[model samples]
Target: MPVSSATSTAESPPAAVPSATVPHSWEYDGTEPFPEKEPAAPRDRGERLYVAVTAAIVLAPFLALGLAGWLLWGRLIHPADIVLALVLYTVTGLGVTVGFHRGLTHGGYRAVRPVRIALAVAGSMSFQGDVIGWVATHRRHHAFTDRPGDPHSPYRYGTHLRGQLRGLLHAHVGWLFRNSRTSAARYAPDLLADRDIRAVSRAFPALCLLTLALPFGLGWAIGGTLVHALTALLWAGLVRIALLHHVTWSVNSLCHVIGDRPFRTRRHDRATNLWPLALLSFGESWHNLHHADPTSARHGVDRGQLDPSAAVIGLLERLGWVSDVRWPTPDRVAARRV
Candidate 1:
């Protein structure tokens, strides 16, 4: 949900690694008040178009849930639809957690070129955003954290009850509708310079189509009917997207406000470890440790914590698909604990 801010002071945890080898230098204490700003206006035609497209992406899948329920009531959902949805959800969720967030944004591991490209494409298909844009925004989130520059900090509106309520909604989904674009040139220069990642970013629209089409095609082939295909599109395509969208957004909204803060982060950085979301978010809900050590390959470092994304990275590392993985050391974890 966040990243490292300015480097820690003499009293801060020395073991924590800032993302992409950047050093934190911001001097704010945790006591600083959040600076509120006027809402952004979509003044240009392109800005309006951006808002329209974002609305379609965010709302269409959510609306599909009602239709999915209607179809479920009619007993139209087949075993094939369920299977396809599970497969796609797992693939795309890991693509975002393992690929976009940990691997690309934080530089947690060095992946083989092919594996890197494949992960980028898979993450792109998640319909979050283009690979480069997602990385840039996430990096910026880390850089500014809950301060004024954070794109979707729930604390942006201050810590009051009314402001917190409004900020939660803003962080959850309202941020997507705003035209506050994170510049890839400033935040994700590495991705911008990569030829393969650039191509994947440009192919985002095509991949969005492919993500839906694959389920439809598979369902039609397996069930031998247009009805099966349509159901699969509903369940695996739109419904799956909606679930992932809310879960990811929950990390940004709920994780910060609720859950246990086992680790210390920069001033005003209120990341928390939300266990209820751990299974669904593939370990990304271990937000406290993540903000504490942004570059660590593993977020769920405690016993009995389920982290499928970390497991996947471990598997890839063993297979020689990735190296230099910034797995959390026991001493480092202990040092950062509150």
Candidate 2:
């Protein structure tokens, strides 16, 4: 049940877990003898295509929405548009949290065929890169964490406030446009071996189109007007994506910089649980516990800690769409207490 330096909670006493039931361990202590894993010939900011795409996703939404609100006044943001955005946000956000991070990256549970495919498709719609690429990047993050090789470590700059600001922006979204790409071959070989996942990864660009277009179509179908379709595209499609992206990225940026470290972990890792983001991030904001027990499936083990993604997994388990769930037990929590 034990793997490496990162998981303080995985090896819980028998009283906490029935036979220490959690299936996998996902701790990465740099002790494994760091190798030169980054691509020898890396892509840099000079890559115009990557820069343009990242810029559009990260900046265009704010510009568009800000302008729309000013010009359209009361007509731009309707109640129905808000509802549509919320629904799309939940599904796609879960796609990133439950589907990509937990299910795909760490193997926290076994998803049935349909559930797996749906998760892959939903996650792809998040515009967070294909499943394999996202997983590879995340796994690499865990492997190196705040160390030199960590792709998005906020501490990479100095500890001064000015340096911290630079690091914050770098971790938030600046690293994304960097020429260096995480080595998928090294970090996500298992996913690369899966043909079904490969097919979904290949369909990433296509799914991006569908994610936006589906909302537009649903809006038109519901309201029976071109204006409704446009609103849906704006609110549900662009705005929702931007919001979820920043929230997820905040786990890397703000979670490391600010928040409570309620659980034990390697000293330098600095992952913390930011409560305000619990609902919006689908429980992913409970990041300190996540770093403490990476493959536990449930990041929010405390009573009041809200984790909608874990609850959804529980429902899926009951429906037989997933199995071998690593629900956190009290013993595991106690064992990892700081």
Which segments of candidate 2 are over 4 A away from where they belong?
A: 1-46
Question: What are the per-residue Cα lDDT tens digits for candidate 1 across 145-199?
Answer: 7776778999867787888898899999999987788877777766777888899
**How many angstroms is residue 114 displaced in model 2 relative to the true structure, after the best TM-score fit?**
1.0
Where does candidate 1 stray beyond 4 Å?
Answer: 1-42
lDDT of 2: 0.80
- Give me the candidate number with maximum lDDT: 1
Error of 1 at 23 (Å): 26
Q: What is the C-alpha lDDT of each candidate?
A: 0.86, 0.80
Number of the top candidate by TM-score? 1
